[model samples]
Target chain A: MTLNTWIDLVYLLAAIGFILALKGLSSPKHARNGNLLGAAAAAVAIGFTFAYPEVRAHTLNLVLTLVAMAIGAAIAVPAARMVKMTAMPQMVAIFNGVGGGAAALISIVVFLLEAPGKPAVYRIAEVLFGVLVGSVSFSGSAIAFAKLQELMTGRPITYPAQQAINAVVGVTIVALAVGTLVTGNVPLLVATAVLSLVLGVIFVLPIGGADVPVLISLLNSFTGLAVAASGFTLNNNLLIIAGTLVGASGILLTRMMSKAMGRSLANVLFSAFGSVVTAAGGADGSAESRPVKAGTPEDIGVLLAYARKVVIIPGYGLAVAQAQHTARELADLLMERGVEVFYAIHPVAGRMPGHMNVLLAEANVPYDELKEMDEANPEMSTADVALVIGANDTVNPAAKNTPGSPIYGMPIINADDAENIVFLKRSMRPGFAGIDNELLFDEKTTLLFGDAKDTLAKLVAAVKDA
Target chain B: MSTGILEFLTIFVLAALVGNEVIGRVPSILHTPLMSGSNAIHGIVLVGAILVMGSASGAMQVTLAFLAVLLATLNIVGGFVVTDRMLEMFKPKPVERAPKASDASGDDATGSPK
Candidate 1:
């Protein structure tokens, strides 16, 4: 197969664009643009690929492709629109899995076509990779998706015989792949596919849900390499380049995700820990958090009107209820009353670090108004009213002293030290770490049992009325 | 030389290993910012996949390339949109204008300073 200089140049430009996008995405400020630049490059690459003589022959398949494309676009567009940002990792995994399946299928079809007898060893390598990586990526990703979506529990499904059986299957698959290489026995190829498929499922089965993102990213990298190997088999430059990029990027992303979660990638993959799904019926467990007796919205308004200072502590509950806007409104009301209003943000308050910041920033909370835990904790002791909105563990007193807890020894804001505490939580349920919060039971604390968004809305209305 | 490919492999492996270490140090406090920041890399992945697809031959290459492009696009676009929505969470409001001391029953029946 001959390669054209123009096509190579276009591919090189796309590669440069990818590099730029990756570098730009290192920070939030440039993330959006990074996406656009990368996307534009991809568009160029796609257009060039279709210019090839081989693919242009499918002139009539255009109509079927268009119809299918439209159907996919409609479903994907809405799903992409509706899915919360938190679930983006899972979505990426599902899509990556599909890519892997496609790469594997490509090689299978190419092998079936009967290649001219040359580069026998290289062909063998490609076939082994296409079968192994593609199969694992496909099934492993599907299981990861299931765990993320709660279709399967987040806990590791540990079976004593599991790893042993996987080893046996893994060896068998390798043997078949090698066998097919030596003598293109279709039976060996089929066996290789089946073994790989099962290996994919088993590989991801023990990966706990909490670590699904890492697995997804890693699998994604596998998909890229699979495609790259397939590209070599097909003797396509664009395929090799693009596959290399995806493979490389996926590997990098997986590492980054693992770091963010404070676990090693190896730990995530090999350990049968991390997935701790407490029952959901406990969703309303905040019943014990009954706010200083159920005070009417108007009563809270009365307190806010008289308060000399009111500080709001925002948490994942705040993010979950999507109440940042209303909280800001309440803050404005407090400010107008000659009350000093500040937002106390904990590092790990929401699902991820800086989660609260992103949410608050979205609500246009001034960077100065948001106080870090160290900054906020000192103020809470003196504040007249500490309005805790949907925060749990970061404000929990246990983390400060309990070394046995998962979040033990982690620094937390001293919301319990405040003059008068008002906790706005739906119930007394524990946070993601699956541990109870003693702060909810504090004597000075007022547990307002309701959705953070609704309760905050009521508070805003009452403040306005007052 | 085959050594060039080996060098590239080394760099790739190093990036992945280093990236993992860096992300592990990320406290949950940095979760949102971290994802937003790293998603830029995910975009790069998408672009890389697209470039690959453009040169890929056979039906399978076509499919993998397109699929990678689509998913990565969704991640980039969706990530930004969601971040915008989340910002709505912290918008400031008007200051509290009234001052009243209400009791436990929540019934503020008394009319105070107008």
Candidate 2:
């Protein structure tokens, strides 16, 4: 077979491989094999590309490609191996950003190589789109990684006219894009890329940390679109197919994430851009002045030991304190006493969807015991004791009770409906959304103040003694 | 080339529809791995990098192509490996080891679980 035919065949196989990978990824049982298939496809694609006649003709470039692959593996292997599960989101952000940056660079190089006024308008447009979207994904993802890693404050950082400033930057990028196409100015193209990167950073700065999962998915979509545009420039079929697949899925994921948060995509992206309006719950002086029922480890232990049914609510703070095992141990203790135990997990409980489930899974929590928000809410009413571990916003009553509250539309675990509520928290501070949990001040709720791990250990000991 | 572009457009639209349908049914539990998994798919841009590198005519073009190849490789390799690691953890253990009566004894051994 001719070299071109071989490349085409390999691309076809790779496309099929990726499709099966996604299908397999949908279920845990097949996820590992799906990943392996993708890796094998990538290997085939990369290996065949090296055997192409064009590549063979340029020995120096071939060496460079090999060296580049080596460097990539050198960094990727160790980073992926060593990163903690808690930091997985940031890892995804950085890796996805590099993919975007790569696409942008390819567009720049293509534009630089094109002879002046020789390319078709459609080709120029594709390159322009590729550079713009790719640059945005790169810098936007960098900012996201920084926020999630706590390199900077997780709160939304805004200033007066932040959106106005961003709008101006957006307009400048569009103008530069047009200029690059009309005049075939390489410098203008470079300037457009730089401006787009700045725009990406500005775009993400005002989105508070709580909404980062949505932002990451959004940026993932942008990178996918950018790759498709890059494929258009290169006239590659498999690239177009794979890229568009990612683009579509990423978009759907982003929308789902926002819906889960009970916020519109528009509001999540822009509402926090201007003056950060303190939510009504945060501003109301009621939460502070309300008499809070505080409980010690022994009190919580006694309550849990006597309860017939206990529901555990786990959240981001549980992951932050790395207390999944301790929480599980306490649950085990309850189960030994013949008290039923179930874990209630909110869809958007942790940094990412299903984040709490993964943490609980690592602790060997039984799959049957982990309940989705819808499944767990009904049981909350029947549960004799609701043990909340480092979770606030998801269980807050304001989501259903206060119309003026920012989180009013969000679906929460019905912890308030339970007979007794015990919250293991570090302090009276609000959750990621900067709003106090009104449930903390409820008459039935008792706060157990300490680190989640320490408090859970104490609770375990208390339950054992009781 | 125009015919090629049209064919590409057709494939792009079809793939997008397929992506939306396939991903719509994915359970929330696998969303993170799915995101990272698809993140690897776009790394197919490495093909473009290879083509660019092959035809690179100058020092500058070569440098840009090299970086593109490097970044794309990172996305592909890092994305797939990390996803596999995550999915592996999701697998159920052979036995749900009930929290032992001496659970505290194992605390030091499993210290820093992350």
Candidate 3:
């Protein structure tokens, strides 16, 4: 057999590794090993790419490739290692964006190479597809990163004729893509590329911060499709398989994320869902005017220690205060006093799906102690106290009771079912949804205002004394 | 379409189905990790970048190919490293402490019952 055949076989093996890696990642027991296996597969594939006859013949190109790779690794390793767990969503966005950008560049370069000779019409179509989807994914992920990193406002940015403008741009891009396909005009493709980039930015801009996770997932799928288009242009089976895999899975994930929030993909994308602050729940006046029962940490702690069952609902605010460890300590203390305690995790609790799980796992919280929304909701009625740590919307009764509320019809944790509700919050500020939580003003709910970490620390001490 | 494209299309369709089937079962607890892991997998675009760069002749082609390689490299390295870091937290801890006995252990034992 020739060297080419042998290399193709190795590439096939690497592809299988990627499949197994995805399989392993889905299960908790094998997730870490699964990721390691994928890394190994990637390394093998890259190592073999260097052995290709064409690549080996170009010594200078090979040298340049190695140098560029070294520079990329230099930036990636430390950034990956040093990023705070809370910043993980944006980090993923940035990395995905760069990959999309790379795919777009590859397509553009191939198109440029073939333009001189009038490339095949089919090849031109593939190049245009890659340029459009890849550029969109690249810029869309950038905006997502900016939103998550708080470099810009997380709320949806909308103006008059916003949807109309986006529509016009979309049609223009399609027209340009057709122009490029018919005549193979370089300028037409460039215009398509530029407009696609603009389309990505505007596409993501109107999605509220809370919905960015779904947007990111959709953009991730777009990047995958773009890569697959590039694969078609290059006639590389490995790229086609890998890219299609991500594309399909990412779409499913995007749907799943939206479902978790009780919304459709289109609604999440176009509704600009949280842009308008609704005056529901009599929140028209300043928040300070509303009276809420504020309880001292010591008092709340005594109540928690004596309860037969306790449920802790954590949110983005808890993550912001870096209070996962303290929350775990409080749970441990409660369990010591014979209180049955478990964390109730909403699917979209943190910035990304399962984000809270990562934070709690870092704090050494046992997996069994973390109950999903479905499992925990049924137990809410039996619990004596619902300890809400830095969470708001997920536990808001407004979702069920307020029909006109933006978050209406969404499923929420039944925190109201518990006998007593103890909320640890910094202030009366609303959650990411920017709507008043009527539950906070309920009779059974008592607020403890402070930074989550400080309040949790105080609670731990108070629970111990009790 | 040529037989070559047809064959690729077949593979693409099958792979996408397989991906959807496999990923559908991933519980929500691992969604973030799954997203990032798949993000790393698609970084296979680096292979395409390398091939194009190898054949690049002019300065313009070389410059674009170099940027592609660089960006693709960043995607691969950063994607895998970040995913591994996130999954690392999910790794089952070694028995840090004895399991809590039904009686006097006071639930202070850090070891999970599992």
Better of 2 and 3 by lDDT: 3
**What TM-score does structure 3 among the candidates reach?**
0.94
Query: How would you encode candidate 2's per-residue C-alpha lDDT over B1-114 as one tens digit per residue?
Result: 788878988999998998888765667888888888889878878888888888887898999999999999898889988888788778655335546556643652374354
- Retained true contacts (fraction), each candidate: 0.10, 0.76, 0.80
Model 3 docking grade: medium
Clashing residue pairs in candidate 3 are none
Please report, in order, the local distance difference test score of every candidate based on alpha carbons. Answer: 0.61, 0.85, 0.87
lDDT of 2: 0.85
Q: What is the CAPRI rating of model 1's predicted complex?
A: incorrect
Task: Return the top candidate by DockQ.
Answer: 2
Give the TM-score of each candidate.
Answer: 0.71, 0.93, 0.94
Q: List the lowest-lDDT window of 10 residues for candidate 3 chain A.
A: A273-282
Q: Residue A151, candidate 2: how far off, in angstroms?
A: 1.9
Model 1 lDDT, residue A432, Cα: 51
lDDT of 1 by residue, A121-182 (tens): 55666766876787788888889888877787665666667767878998888788888878
Candidate achieving higher DockQ, 2 or 3: 2
Docking class of 2: medium
